[model samples]
Target: MNRSENTATSAAPAKITDSGQFKRSLGTWSTLALGVGAMVGFGWVTLVGGWINDAGTLGAASAMLAGGVMMAVVAFVYSEMVAAMPKAGGEHNYILRAMGPRWSFIGSWGITGGYATVVAFEAVALPTALEYVIPLDHLHLWTVSDSDVFLSWALVGAVTAVIITIINIVGVKIAGSFQMFVVLFLFLIGFLQIFGSLNAGEVSMMEPLFSNGWAGFFTVLVVVPFMFVGFDVIPQTAEEVNLPPKKTGRIAFISVIIAAAWYIMIILTVSSALTPEQQANSSLPAADAMATLFSSEFFGNLMVAAGVAGIVTSWNSLQMGASRLMYSLAQGGMLPAWLGKLHPKFGTPVNALLVLGAVATIAPFFGHKALGWIVDAGSPMIVIAYFLVSISFVILRIREPKMNRPLRVGGRGNFGVIVGATAVAITAFLITLYVPGMPAGLSIEPWIIFGVWWLVGAVFFVGIPGGVKPGPNAEEELMEKVYARYPHRRP
Candidate 1:
């Protein structure tokens, strides 16, 4: 609070030294869609049957319910942090303000990697969905790990990734606009599927709810944080939101509930429509369940079609969110200076967007089935970011108790401690699921993927400019050092 402390900690913000900042164009609806859309990706279509098979129908539902609650607690922390500091880099800014630059980089690094992995997976997933609708693998493009990549399938993913990147580079509004439209369709079909099953769904089909006891429950429970990750997109895109801070926080939490309910309903409807044997044997259980309910294969394929909508929505939003993080880190002099560059005409993170898009464009070469390594790799990264954010929340509460919190979590004097402690406890448990000896231990392949990504992050982590303290002037101070270090660099 003292002048000397201020002077020593950070410098006054310099003039607009970069291309410019993100434009405030995303409204409440678009923002909400971004969150929900990112959460409901193709996971529901491909993984639901496996969830039921592993945990049983009742076990699956219970896992979602319990996992949803844990994620909701983490969302509470994010909502409050976003409300307190409505910035472009959601987790990056929060962690910086609470725990300084090193910790900030770690948390942001983990989450940015998490988001990037999903973007790549969706690239592969889109073509996989197309394969389901129509076998379009005409020209084979070599082979990787027993999976053959066809010219047509590879083209679909690569071209789509490029188009999505261009949309984002043009402006956040356009990307948000596309997200809003597709997510609406996704929701409509999802609602119809659930409603159509009401009269035909059988309760007797849901017997043997808990399979393999607690281990089965843990399998489904651990995957929730990864699936429920979209809610944080609200914060990642906070600066562009054209609503009040409180509303962004409120909509974010609401989106989590919506996504959780959607997943649970899908599980219930599919389980009820088909017998246990049917669930275990069927590759496309959700589509099959819809077909059985409506007595039409048309409706079943329609569900798969809706899942394609989900893939696009999730892919687009994650790119939007992740690029901002890359920009934020570069803006703070962590990564190369140009990665934070905004488009002079569009006010978008041009360089950062392209970097993510380039990698995603190559994902199709591996084929969709082999992309599980990426999804598994990213899940723990996301969980680690959540844990760090919770710790940041508690740190800020104690270090700067007077900081604004437009969406405070708890009540009275004990609020921050209670909420922060609870989030830490839950996320810690979630992290264990991927560790060795756990019920749902991750494979070596995923761990290797995770290691490679973090090593890249560590390069940037160690390169951050010195004396970068957490406060209003953090970015300003960081830029000063960056400009001073590289005199040739320009705004």
Candidate 2:
């Protein structure tokens, strides 16, 4: 192997700095917490029952493990990319460098939609989690999709959204610290459940380990990607991490491993502690399982509180990711340049934060019924971005073989190519799951939402002057045009 080809060139800096750069305040542990906190959100509390029902105990755990493996491959690709070009927009920088501006816009937009939807989902999820602990008075404010919209419930989500947004705007350190504290509590709850399950759970409840055969397994596998989606948040905020590039890359991969273990543990704990009939009767099976295992309702309520903590961690992290992506797009001339501006004091993307924050705050007003649709709609988009990034990984490996990779996957050889190729194949397979008639195909509503989002993206794509052309100078050209469009943003 040529040593010259192994080191990064000056063209790709270890740290990307500009007049409007973000504050590098996130340390190693904080960065890891960002990814882990985002991954271990409220889904486990509400979705564990469905996972058990669809695929039984071992089946669901297997699917989650499989999904983790697939995502781990993808994370390896991200690890190299982020290590090589540690920038604010994770996939944006990778895609742009490999495939140029047009495809970069598509990939960035795909992830932005994915992150935004999750932010909105968490906004609504917060209220839903609260309702489990303290029942809200229904001041009926209309309905959507047959689910009644209530003022009191919606207000809880909306207010939390505002507070979370403020926390982010205050600074990344504040948000990262808050995430670490909340994630610790979540881990404590997880430990309690694991210990309780060991003490009181019966193995008989785990019967029918593979329900409905392949169909059930595929159903669980399709959503596994979504559950493991948060690990990528590390790449989005790569520019703000106060750590070595290689360590940052390692954290991304580690987060995926932690999440895999977390999901598997949750499945085993839930299944062992509750019978099929018990799970069927309970809306929140994980909480019920904790309650049953500990023989106390307080533990169940404590589990619900953990779910709320999950919501906050996820909501805060995704908002940070989505805003940085928007800021990246604007800086690259894919979106309005004004969105690229950073706050002088906080060094955060205030304008972009406000825009996404506003969207999240309004999400609650539409009611919780749209949560499912938002998730399904966002799934394909997230996978699409992953697919494109996988392709970019291969492209960069072949095109810039000597490019510096602080945390190179598979070492400096053809093995890295094999890893990238595997990622491409896996993401391609995941994409097909969303197509109509597939075992894990999305519903018509999500399809419609997916179509509308792309259509909107197309409109923005057309609006760019002269359109973005793929080449060596694509980024520079795009930035030049952006500066021309918004002179005040020129830096």
What TM-score, over all chains together, does every model reach? 0.94, 0.95
lDDT (C-alpha, whole model) for all candidates: 0.84, 0.86
Off by over 4 Å in 2: 1-19, 465-473, 481-489
Superposing all C-alpha atoms, what RMSD in Å does each candidate have to the true structure? 2.7, 2.5
TM-score of 1: 0.94
lDDT of 1 by residue, 74-165 (tens): 88888888877787878888887777778888999998989999999999988887777798779998887788889898989999999999
Candidate 2, 381: how far from true, in Å?
0.6
Instruction: Report the lDDT tens digits of candidate 2 across residue range 1-491.
Output: 34453333313322222535678999988999999998888898888888889999999999999989999999999988888878888988888878887888899999899989999998888888888788775788988888788899899998888898999999999999999999999999999999998899989888879898888888899887789888889989987999999999999999999999999999999999998888888888989999999999999999999888888988888899999898888777678767877887898989899998898899988888887798789988999999999999999889878776778899988999999999999999999988889877888899888889999999888766565555344566666676667666555
